[model samples]
Target: MATLKQVARWVPSHWGAGHLVLAGFLALLVLAVSPVIKLDLVVNGLFLGAIIGLGAIGLSLVYGILKFAHIGHGDFMTLGAYFALFLLSDLFPRIGLTGAGLGPFTFGYPLLLALPLAMLAMAVVAIALDLGIYRRLRRRGVNPVVLAMASLGVAIALRGVVQIFWGGGTEQYPRVSKLFYRLPMDVRIPPDNLFVGGLTVVLVVALYLFLTRSKMGKAMRATSDNPDLARVSGINTEHILWWTWAIGGALAATAGVLLAVSQAQLVPIMGWRLLIPLFAAVILGGIGNPFGALVGGLIIGVTSEISTQWLNPSYKPAMAFLVMIIMLLFRPRGLFGAKD
Candidate 1:
């Protein structure tokens, strides 16, 4: 028989017996249902999970590198979607790109192209933001709390700018008529969802590879782990900071574009409302842990969607807060976070 300490060491840090038990319970609950729940809801939940995961990744990167919670991060996502909106509006007519717009391709095709462009645009914007606001503050040696406040101000100001350009009305991407997959119960899956999900997986895997395999990625990890040590080791702190902002901004934009295509709508508050769940995902996954953030996003997305079956649809947003509070009370360091 193994001693408790030995058994503890054998288990994965984030996947102890308790987590296994919870997983088993959830599985049993799903199996016990007489008639299956709505397939649409499950599929939608998965799609939502992917979008939230993308946004959460960005938040995790920023938290890890910048050592502050960026309340304004979601705005970057909104900015990306708006960028796509403008591009689509301009390109569609000229290129005669109609109904998914990739020349006999599905809805996913246009989005596939749009997402990268949006990400690049957002990355540029992030660099600019750093240069304009954060760099100045860093030079002044401002405290992290003050920097957090500055992020909030940036959020509000960006919202104002978006409103001025796009106005307060809701707009949508052109709807694609083709369905990628159809289910047994008359449920339809759009190409956009497939595209979004595929893109999310690719990005997540790529990010993981970059973090683990690339030199810059290692430098970023070093900085996140300990800025003082990184500086002492001659790591270019400024370059790493710029990369963090750029990567975070790009991820946020990608999330925004994905959400827009999935919902087919662009609203100023889209990203703002999403911030709650994004934060919840980040915290639940473990602060400064990208993998944790990914899992957290999925959990939040599924729970929120499932809860809608029991609670009012309007209460879905509150479910994230409830989960966050519970996690904070029980596992303050989050599921994957390192314990002090």
Candidate 2:
């Protein structure tokens, strides 16, 4: 009982309960119409939303810690996916892992080997970006808006660089066929989606644990809340900043890889296009609240997917912007933002 209380205090009560109820209601609705609607839509939406949630969490971290909008975040995601693509195409083949050699692996299986490599590469890139641009600006005492503009420029440059290397054409994941889980009444769920969704949940839970239970994680929280105080309290602000970028970059890369795996396509502009919606999720949840970011991400993902049923799919991204605008107008602190 004592343990449960401690856990409950760490995790938000109303939000968790509310989301569970909402998810339950959604499941019921899907079951009620299971006879009519294809199970693929529900499964696909859930899976895709999970991937979106991953990227959204990274964006939230950047916003929460750095206190600036990172418009280029999606590009970083795209870079991670492209990095994975390069690894698979160039490196994987040379190591006697060619053709059906890779067939033994399924998206359902944990990417034990590839995941860390991808995360490391993305973290390096993120730190490089900070060293090259953001750090310089901070040293010069540049305003946050200037920093935001610089990030936008960096985003565009990164996108162009990706296009130059990978070509402007869409690249597809090789050999991995979509496996479906068959159910009654012709309903099928993609195993890849299930894998991605499950991985996302695990990542989020792990992040929550790290943030609340670990020493460095608490230092990160302290830094985000009050940098001066954290610094004065003997916390190494520089170390925290490095970890923040590293974690954010790694998560962004993970999201990119999962998204590409689920969709089986990688394009340079794909991540850039996702930027707005990702930011919307971050802002909607609360600028600096990781838990809020998770809920906000889930909300954005589900809402975007469901909106396709009622409106044209082309306008789906607009939904994010609309939500952001409304939130800004009504609740500037966001749905679960702290009352600072």
Candidate 3:
């Protein structure tokens, strides 16, 4: 508890206050809605939050280390989803491994196999983008705005590729419906939702362990704190950068897959549409703090879901934007951000 308090002191009071306000608002909202409905919305929001948190972690990591807005990150997520689609529906079928559903689950062995491969492919793609484009720009000492613009171009190209290959229509993973389990509070939830929530927890814990216990993770943290100092201190900054993209890309892939699973459909613009909420999560959490991103994601998700009671469901992204603006007005540094 003492250690936690000391860490809390690093954040500005205004940010903490803003969080309190948000929390109070949410509590009031819960009171306004019926108990059963509120519980349902909150549970669904958590499933959504898990996906957003995974994506936000990657965004935070890239920004922390690379210091540029990765506009193409969302498209990379789209690409990862498509990769899984291809593997699960196309390649595996040919190899006589159908994407059969496991007991009480929508996915089976093929998905389990395709997931890691998709993550690996996405990681490689991220590295290649760095080596082919961003690295060259960095070497030339281009401004961050230019890098951001370049990423925008990459984003366009990636979306185009998806459109060309998959068409502009929606896609879905091969699967069947799973029965919802009734909980103690009469809350019924799908198995896939439980899977997403559990996997997210595991990933977050693994990330925490990696950041605190592993040498490479420590190097990444040092690089994020001060790249020049880390380089001078015998840390291989370039290698750290590569690992950053690799980890970020893998996480993005996982988020994309989970989103597809939860939503049961995919569109070419799925990732692009998600980009706004993702940015909201990142900004609300803190620009470069991964854990902050996770917290921000949950807040945004819950708020968006609860708002549907009064607002149009399509306004979900707007809820995130509104929350972000509100937070910034009180605390631009975000909940866990330290002073510059």
Which regions in candidate 2 have their CA more than 4 angstroms from the true location? 1-42, 99-112, 184-187
What's model 1's overall lDDT?
Answer: 0.82
TM-score of 2: 0.86
lDDT of 2 by residue, 120-235 (tens): 99999998899889989988998888989999999999889898898999996554564567887565776666657778888888999999999999999999999899999999
Best by TM-score: 3
Between candidates 1 and 2, the lDDT winner: 1
Model 1: per-residue lDDT, tens digit, 1-340?
8765555555466585348448744873683352556656666777898899899998998897888889898898898999888777667547865446454334535555666888899999999998999889978998888888999999989888889989989997766555457777645677667777888898999999999999999999999989999999999999998888888999999999888877878999899899989999998888888888888888788778877877898887799989898777666677777777
lDDT, candidates in the order shown: 0.82, 0.77, 0.86
Which candidate leads in lDDT? 3
lDDT of 3 by residue, 153-271 (tens): 99999999989999999899999887788876556788888889988999999999999899999999999988999999999888998999999999999999888888888898988
What TM-score, over all chains together, does every model reach? Answer: 0.88, 0.86, 0.91
* Model 3: worst 10 consecutive residues (lDDT sum): 8-17
Lowest summed lDDT window (length 10), candidate 2: 100-109
Candidate numbers sorted by TM-score from highest down: 3, 1, 2
